[model samples]
Structures are given as C-alpha cells and as structure tokens.
Target: MFDSMDEERPTASEPAVRRSRSLFEKHGLRATRQRIGLAKLLFSKGNRHVTADALAVEAHAARMTASLATVYNVLNLFAQVGLIRSLAIEGTKTIFDTNTSDHGHFFFEDTGEVCDIATDEIKFAGDLEPPEGYEIVAVDVVVRLRPKSGSVPFSA
Candidate 1:
C-alpha cells in the first residue's frame, strides 16, 4: 500500500514521497496531492500496463478521492511527459505502460492485457528505411494474440 501522504506535505525523509516529488520535478510537472497519490499507485507496483478505468478502481480501493476524469487526465499527462508509454489498441482503447524503454508488446486480444516483448525478441529481415527527409523514430510492434481451440484465454 502507498503511504497516506495525501493530507500532509511530503518531506525529504520519506523515500516514497521524495521519489514522487522528484519524478514530477524531473518531468517539469507540479507535484499536486492528487497527482502524487496517483503516481505512487501507478509506479509503486513496478512496470506494468494499466487503463484509466482500472486505475480508478484501484484508487477507489485505496481510498483515493480521484475521479475517473481526473484519472484519465493524469494518465494522459503522464504519457505526454514521457513518464509512461501509451499503447493505442482496439480502436480507442488505450493502455498506459510504466516502462518507457524501446520495446514492443504482446497484446492479448481475449483478455485485453498487454505484455512486454524485448527488443531482441523481434528482428527485421532487412533495413527498415523511412520516407525521404524523415528519420525513423521508434518501431511500435503490437503482436496480437488469442487462445487457440480448446485453450483458455489468459485472464487479466
């Protein structure tokens, strides 16, 4: 569980609080109470994929007063600041990933959960050249997967 630093001001002595503050400062964002609480929840569990709705449920379970709209806004902001990576899947559905490194993912279609795939796991046959006057950015590969016949789909 995250520390109950919502009511009180964060101090340097508290490692988690300090980390949260440092994250915001490093990303040029103001460490508001709501954002700090959400950050603690989002990051404390280590790297993983999360949706705003799922995070809202976790926040509610953790007794956080963040609304769904607030959760969505904060998640978008975090993605925009490069604190997290947003994966656009299934049309408008988005999953926020904590690990911002260069990597692909295994998208489970049945369960709608995403898993990371290392850069070495996938290899291109030939040189992937970009268009004229354009440099290649990151290659986002989302390999969608589904359970075969008689096999059960993994639960999220």
Candidate 2:
C-alpha cells in the first residue's frame, strides 16, 4: 500500500520550472525570452527526453523561427548549466533530457524510442575503479536499437 509520505511528494512539474530559473541564475545566464521559452519547452512536463530535431519541430510549430544553430547553441548552454543532459541514442541522433539526476536509459529496440531507466535498477559488477585522482562524474548507457518489423524506422 502507498503510504501518506509517498502521497505527499511534489509533482514533477514544479521542480522543472523552479530548477530552470534557479539554474539560469546560478550559472549567471541571462533570462532571455528565447532561453525561457526553450527551457519551458524542455522542462515544462518535468524532465522528459527529446531530440533536437523534435524540439526544432516544436519550436517551428510554436511560430518561433529559431535556427538549428540557435537551437544547438541553447542546448549547449543548457547542458553547460547542468540544466539538462544529452545522450547520443544509438542508431539515431542525440537526445536531450531535462532530468539532471543520475539515471540510465533504455532504447526500445523495436521502436527506436528512448526512455529513462531508474539508476537503482541497474547493477554494476567488478571492482572497476577510476584511475588514481579521477572521479567518476557520470555514467551513460545507450542501448542500440533495431525494429522487429525487419524494416528500417524513419529517422528525423
């Protein structure tokens, strides 16, 4: 049964907005219209992953004439600020994530769809250690994909 403590957790949406602003401020980033708009697009629903091409389409649909270069720039800025994470989805293109927390990803082999897998669900074996003074900052796991239909999936 779910306990009252579990029921009281804040909705995921709240943190995205709060974190967006805080991150911008923390990084001394100017709160430009383009930046805020992009932040909302990336984090509005709270840490969902998306591709640059997909985001460009969404921006275009919103009547925002942002060039691909601009999109890339903003993405890089966001990434630098730790406001989002980026991953190169195997057999596809790079994707952006608003969830900055440590986590793993899963690629639906049949659909080429990428999704986050809980970090706790992943177990590492062996005594692999980071070389002397180096620290393991982050880990990214990408699952290569293929469609079961025996037909190639469309790429963006």
Candidate 3:
C-alpha cells in the first residue's frame, strides 16, 4: 500500500519530477530550482484554477522561493507548452488552470473561483460559421455565476 499522499496523486509523485524535467527540457526551458518548486506546488494540488498572485502566496506558504514576476513568467511558459490552460475572465483577471483538457468552466463572480464543467456538459447545438479564410480552432465556454438575491454568501 502507498503511504505518501503524492502516491495518490500520480502527477505529483516521484515520476512527476521526471515528467516536469522532461516537459521543460522538451520545451527548451531549464529545470531550475524555482521552476521545479513551482511545478510541484501547481501539480501537487488537484485540478484547480489560480491566479499568479495566488500562486505566489502558495509558494511563500510552502517556503518555495519565487518572485511574483517569476511566477507569472513560469505560468505563461507552462501555458505556452500546453501544461496548463489560461482563462482570461472578469475583464482584467487571468486565471491559470491546472487541468489542460478541453473543457468548460464555471466562474463565480463573487468569490473569483473557477470550477471545471465536463466537456460533454455543454453541447454546441448549432454549427459555427467562420470567416472567409478562418477556421474554428476551439470554443471556450465560461459560465459566470452569481448568487441570487437574498442568497447566503460564500463561506471560506
């Protein structure tokens, strides 16, 4: 039986180190200490969405050294290499999602939390029409949610 929690999270286990190294190497990024530490923190937690500020806070809490700018750069790099998905929502807010699969998201306006919606949960009934020389690559659906009037506020 596996005793470590990392064992339960395959991508967070020992092999994750190898995976992260290879992923960075394949994309021509050096597996620096800060990069590896940030990668572990991002993947160790289950699928979730976080902003660069939030990641920086997590890094500080975990005692992993990384600047907010470095966090942003690493996140952008990861997104570029298909390691994570970037969601630009609520005007100037950008959230990084650890789950890179093609799926929809539920954005809670009040709490600024993002939850994944299964790919099949949303169905595109009508066909999409692209411009003269353009093709439809991907359609991202983000359902914004707000509590109804008189509803209880989100706790924690």
Candidate 4:
C-alpha cells in the first residue's frame, strides 16, 4: 500500500493523500510523516469517530508508537484542515469525527460511547439566528442516553 505514484492516474489512496497534502499546505501546515500517517488513520474508515485514548491504543496496537501528544496534535491539525470535527460532550473528554457533514451525535451515558445521528432524522421548527459577527456553521445535537437494562422507561 506504500507504492509510489506515477504521473498518470494514481491509486485510490494516492488521491486521498494528495488531497490531504493540499489541505495541509493550504492551512499553512508543514506536512510531516507523523501527520500524514495520522491523517491516513483518521480518514481510512468511513463513518467512524474516536477519542484520543482510543486512537492512542490503536496506534500502539499497530506498532506505530504515536504518542498521545502527537495524536492530539494530529487531531488538531486535521480539525484545522476541515478534515474532521471535534466534539466535547458535557465538558469532558473530546471525540474526533470522520464525517464532516452536518450531523448530530448520541452519547451513551452508560458506556460513555459516542455515535453519529443523521441530520435528516431531526427537525427544528423555530426561528434560529446566529450572533452578530459569526454565521452559524453547523449544528450538533448530543442526546445523552443509557442502555435499557430491564424495561424501557416511559419517557424514553
């Protein structure tokens, strides 16, 4: 998978790598080996999100030896490039999203896991306006939840 690209049509991964490089270059970021590897890891899977701790474990398992600080730096860099989005639920641990589209999240309180919720499933009927200088970019709704241990609650 590490084959070098030619002048003609490149491999699937090559285009992605080129796009990532362009994004990094546009954002005034110096593309490095670690940053490229981290970007590949983050964009390899579709519809996947992960926490820093989880990413560190994956990196260790893959024998990549990406330090926690390096992971955070890579994540921040990816966020800066508009390649991923970060969410901090309840002022706690932050999670990184691979899907950059407008969507919401669901936090499983019992497991402390986060999942993406489609934007089409939700509807807002009230007039919403942004603040003076800043325009509303995206909307994220995180529904705190817990697994049904026994019977589902009436309110649920």
Candidate 5:
C-alpha cells in the first residue's frame, strides 16, 4: 500500500493502534516509539503484502524515522506474534504478507510482483507423509506467472 501505485489507501483506527500496542506487549516486545510508528504504518493499510525495503522507505516517508535494520527487526517482532507471514518470492527477496492464512499467491514475472490468489480459484492435491519423529506441517503454493502478451526477452 505504501509503495504501490494505488491512488487511495486505507487508514487504521485508534482502536487498532491500541490493539497493535497490546500485541507488542503480548509478544514481549517493547512498545517503543519506533515500533509503534512502524506498526501504525503497517496495519493501517489493511491486509496487504510489502517488501522490507519498500516498508523501510514508507516508514521514513510517514515520519517514522527508522533505519532499514530497525525496520527488519520490528517486522520480525510482528511476524513472531502471527500478525504476518513471509513469502520467499524465489531464491531471494522475502515479502511480508499481512493475511496470515492458508492461501496461494500469483507472482508476476514481468515486474517481480505478487498478490494473493483467491481461495476458491485454485485447488491443491497432495499426500504428505512425515517420517518418524516428524510432523506434517502447512503446505504453501506459489504460482509464478508471465505476462499474457509474452515474457520479456533476454538483455545484454
């Protein structure tokens, strides 16, 4: 929402702010100025995904006055509380997702972008078997996509 080209963005309410602060406390994280600033910038936009770099940029623009390192630290805090989930786009670039549920994503190859795939749009089929002393966990699907016209050719 912060770095996106969307014309409008949603805002978080005072109650949400209070809840966010409480969440930090619940997770044993200090409700510092920087943490609160980043939380407000993040939750205010509703359920959306954003890269850490993009979030750092937005935090500064919003007058949060936090460094990239600090942003990553704060993000890790929220993630620990189950407020967000991280999706590794590929071998590099981890995107922080707000909607912490079982769902797939569509990765745009053209712009290296991603968005959640509606739950009813796709179906999953698999039989998981865990070895002894191991437990089967969640299954995440990442469907990579190329532009309809055609994928861009190689560059020099």
Candidate 6:
C-alpha cells in the first residue's frame, strides 16, 4: 500500500504543495504534517466534490492513516477558511466542494454524482423576499435529476 505513497509523494517543486501551503497559511491554519498531506490531496483535485468518508478511502489507499474524524475536522477547518464549500444533501451526505466560488450543481439521484452547472445556463425570476429584519446572504441552486420514467426497468 505504501509503495505508491513513496513513489508518488509530492516533491518540493510541486505546485500543489506550494499552493496548499500558501492556502493554509493564508487561512491562519498551522501547516502540520497531516494537514499538509490532506491539503495536497484536496487542493490538487481541482474543482470537484468529496465526502469525508471518501477522502478517508483515498488516504487509506495511499497508506496514510488519518482517521475519519480527522478528515471531518480538517474539512470543517478548510470551509471555515473559505477554502471549500460544504453542502448538505438529502439530510444524509455532506459534500465538500473544492471550488469556493459561486456556482450551482446538478445532482444525479441514481449515480449520486454532482456536476457543475454554469451560471449563464440558468436564470431566476420572481420575488426573493424574506421576513422583516432578516436578510438572505446566499442562495444555492441544486438541480436534482432522475432517470426518465420510460427508462425504468421494473416497478415496485
């Protein structure tokens, strides 16, 4: 397991290492060994979403032993620093997005995949009024999709 770890370990000249280090420092987070390792993986993945459990799997595959709790803690910290965006879906899975900008996603119910939806491809209308003295800071648009009805192979 660790053979891959040794083979692919990030070198000093790698941009991911430098960028993740700068990101952590910018967020006032101490660059610990584990945090650096996780940061490399997270920031290097480009614009994508991931869950703590899934990240743990990647770490395990790399022969790294950071626990799930540690992954969650690091993820929370990353979000707090505006390094990632967190989304709660279906009251179950929480996804962490590497893209920290304003954008929407398309959630596929069958495959559990989330893909980016370009802002220009969508539009909103009507009122967004809120209760008195309250304000809405941000609104996220998530389009949920399912297979076409005709594609169903069986019925309950």
lDDT digits (tens) for residues 1-156 of candidate 2:
012222222346566445556557767898777776776676556557887788888888888878877888899887776667888776447788877666777777666677777767875422558899997777777656565576767442
Query: Mind giving the per-residue lDDT tens digits that candidate 6 earns over 45-91?
Result: 55678999988888888777799999999998977766678888768
Return the TM-score for each candidate structure.
0.82, 0.73, 0.81, 0.77, 0.77, 0.77
Best by lDDT: 1
Better of 3 and 4 by lDDT: 3
| Poorly placed runs, candidate 5 (over 4 Å) | 1-13, 125-129, 148-156
Candidate 2 matches the true fold with a TM-score of: 0.73
Cα TM-score of candidate 5:
0.77
Per-residue C-alpha lDDT of model 1 across residues 1-156, encoded as one tens digit per residue:
012223322344677667788868977999998998998889877778999999999999999999999999999999898788889988998999887766788898787888988768777423888889997655677889999989877764
What is the C-alpha lDDT profile of model 5 across 32-137, one tens digit per residue?
Answer: 8888788778867777788889999998788778999999887876776666777888787888887776688888776777888887886553466678998745
The candidate, 2 or 4, that scores higher on TM-score is 4
lDDT of 1: 0.81
Q: Give the clashing pairs for model 5.
A: none
lDDT of each: 0.81, 0.68, 0.78, 0.70, 0.72, 0.73
Could you give me the TM-score of model 1 versus the true structure? 0.82
Clashing pairs in 4: none
**Residue 22, candidate 4: alpha-carbon lDDT:** 67
- Per candidate, the number of residue pairs that clash is 0, 0, 0, 0, 0, 0
C-alpha RMSD (angstroms) for model 5: 6.7
Which residue pairs collide, candidate 1?
none
lDDT of 3 by residue, 20-128 (tens): 6876786688998888889888877778789999999999999988999999999998888767788899887789987765578888889888888886776642477
Residue 80 lDDT (model 3): 80
Off by over 4 Å in 1: 1-14, 124-126, 152-156
